[model samples]
Target chain A: MSRVSSKMALAVKCSDTFNADACMHCGVCTAVCPMGIEMLPRKLFRYVQIGLEDKVKENISTIYSCLLCGMCAENCPAEVNIADNVRFLRKYINENEFNLS
Target chain B: MPLPTKDILGILADNLNQRKSVLPISSAAATRWAKGLDLPKGGKTVLYTGHLYQLIPIIDAMSGQMAKFEDSALTKYFGLGRNVNKFINMTFFMGMMASKDEQKDYDRMLRNIALLLKKADVDFGYLYGEELYSGALVYDEGVDGSFAKHAQRVADMFKKNGVEKIITVDPHTTHTLRTVFPEFVKGFDIEVKSYLEVLAESGIEPTNQITDDLSLHDSCVYARHENVVEQPRALLAKTGAKVNEPRLCGKNTHCCGGPLESLFPSESHRIAGNRVEQLKEAGGSIATMCPICLVSLRKAAKGSVKVNDLSDTLAKAYGV
Candidate 1:
């Protein structure tokens, strides 16, 4: 069985057109994140915008560790929905069959 | 004998609106204030037993002298009472007595608490100095005849009022009214339910069509105490909006750092921030049930995610 099946699947699927063009690649999200799990909100936004689902999934734990408070969204010059995208990614990860290796 | 439903609903709606606009301190503060009033030494101890909703501060106040009263536990759970004297004097005992105006405040607080508790099935008694001081009022019935009678009268009024459905918004009221009051008030026909349950049952849709994905903040009162885990989710699901479940959801839901609000505002902010991060990780706008939870989470939220109440959501969904 694939590790994808081993992990819990999300009930919702990520929309293919889920875009994060507004992200400014600022490190503010990483700074305010309570867990101290380093993740560049802009970089994740870039990868997701480009349809790099594998790259987004690679950093899934860091994304999952977000508290979803929206400090980064407030601070973002681009006003990217960082938290929403993170949730979308989580739902995608849980719902879709993806190869971890 | 039933009270008019419109009147009851009006009262409830007014109370809910008041609570929403003005943040009432936890019931624990009232208990402490009551203790500080220096009720004559002989007064009976009217135990208001319930969950750690607002009543926790009161419970802590009453059990102040007991060895089991651990300050650290309170600080750990609630983040109150850094100093021993402050814990005992300020947080616990000092709140017992307020001035005349303060007494009015106390009356309002107590009345609201009473109404909420009555709806939940909890009975309350006014403690007289003599009975409390003497400790003569054991667990036996009629130990305090007048006190018991007054409680019975209130319960009877509720039963006569056609209050077939009594929903408490606060968990402390729910636990006490549902679990403890039945022991004292015989033949009380009120069915204690939580406000979240009522909201869920009302079938009100989320008014705000949140196209953005969202997360659910499981409040301690709604999630752990009342087991209202699915109701909010069901409401969120109604919006046809995707919900991201947090790692620490449902009964395992974290405190929004509410208990520590007074004691360690900054640390509480950090805890709230931490929970917000979890919601963010789940990724989306945040929805909660409890008013306190909504307020606490919003303060910490700092606008990272959208925070709204289930009712507010339904109002948006229904365009009401």
Candidate 2:
């Protein structure tokens, strides 16, 4: 039942802060995460990059659980803003799913 | 079985929107720390707590309740609790569970910051009861719309008070005021500095010497976002205390697992326990500059190692 929405992908790509595409999948972020959530910014960025809404939805609890401590973004050789990207997903979820705004 | 993130976030947003703080603390309780300090009301330069330190005990108490709820079947009722909280403010009862001694401990830390500023001969005023919570938790939780509105309100309050500069107490408040606020509030030109930064620049020599080793836990906001890494270290150095850096320090500092404390208590504690292990390996008494870090590490350490606010260590060295 899940289909990629170009709109969602476009919105995420256009965000200056959510540089998920720049993620190199090096696992540096996962190594540093205190929560030890295995996928974290690395896999989460991949989900965002491929426009896998279902994947992101499946990991919604994981998304909300991020510490957003910037430890990943700081250590990322790709210089992706991992924490801000997580914030973007949270903001996205808050708006689309929860209808907070 | 999933954490009730939506319910928790919704409740926090509602509180921020209505009460001007994520937690509903009375003005009297919030301002009790500044009593007998004789700090003036407002001026061009002011000390803005953002209630980060003041709200800690309540946050701790509520998190304890939340941990219990998470382990039991009561977790499902969080949605109903959120709805009920809209009218009754159930967190008020949670706030009652905050230990008086813990509240006083946090208050004393604020007092020490003030006393240290005075010792440095830096002139600052307090907003006292007029201060707002800076919407840090909502902002951190990605409740941007609520945060934006609250940030505007805070900026307007500053404008009304003629506050040109703000000296912040904790890292989260410092980062929000220094970096995040400017983005949300256009022309938000207030000069923001942490008391650590102010004291570092002041070259305030400590009145006493503490020849003890300490592990400094840097708040992620202060270390990475705010570029406040050296200020606290330099201030601590003046106290004659040698600070041992854990594996992750400075811009690469690890989180205290705080940002998730409200939404995911168990995960937060798990992270905190991990950080405590790293800090303990570094050897020495632990010193955390941020209130969240202090509480998190202290909870995880569980008296295995002494964890304290940096202010307590600095206050001891300053003989305040």
lDDT of the candidates, in the order given: 0.47, 0.88
Residue-by-residue lDDT tens digits, candidate 1, A1-101? 11332122222224532446655566776665444556556676656555565676677545544544455655566766665566556445533532110
**Per-candidate TM-score against the hidden true structure:** 0.40, 0.97
Tell me the spans in candidate 1 whose CA falls farther than 4 Å from its real position: A1-101, B1-162, B170-172, B183-189, B202-212, B263-267
DockQ scores of all models, one per candidate: 0.01, 0.82
Q: For model 2, how does the per-residue alpha-carbon lDDT over B141-162 read when each residue is reduced to its tens digit? A: 8899999999999999999999
Candidate 2 local lDDT, residue A66: 86
TM-score of chain A of each: 0.66, 0.90
lDDT of 1 by residue, B21-43 (tens): 01123343434434433332211
Give me the TM-scores of chain B across the candidates.
Answer: 0.49, 0.98
**Candidate 2 Cα errors over 4 Å, as ranges:** none
Q: Which candidate number would show the highest TM-score if scored against the true structure?
A: 2
Report the C-alpha displacement of residue B132, candidate 1, in angstroms. Answer: 23
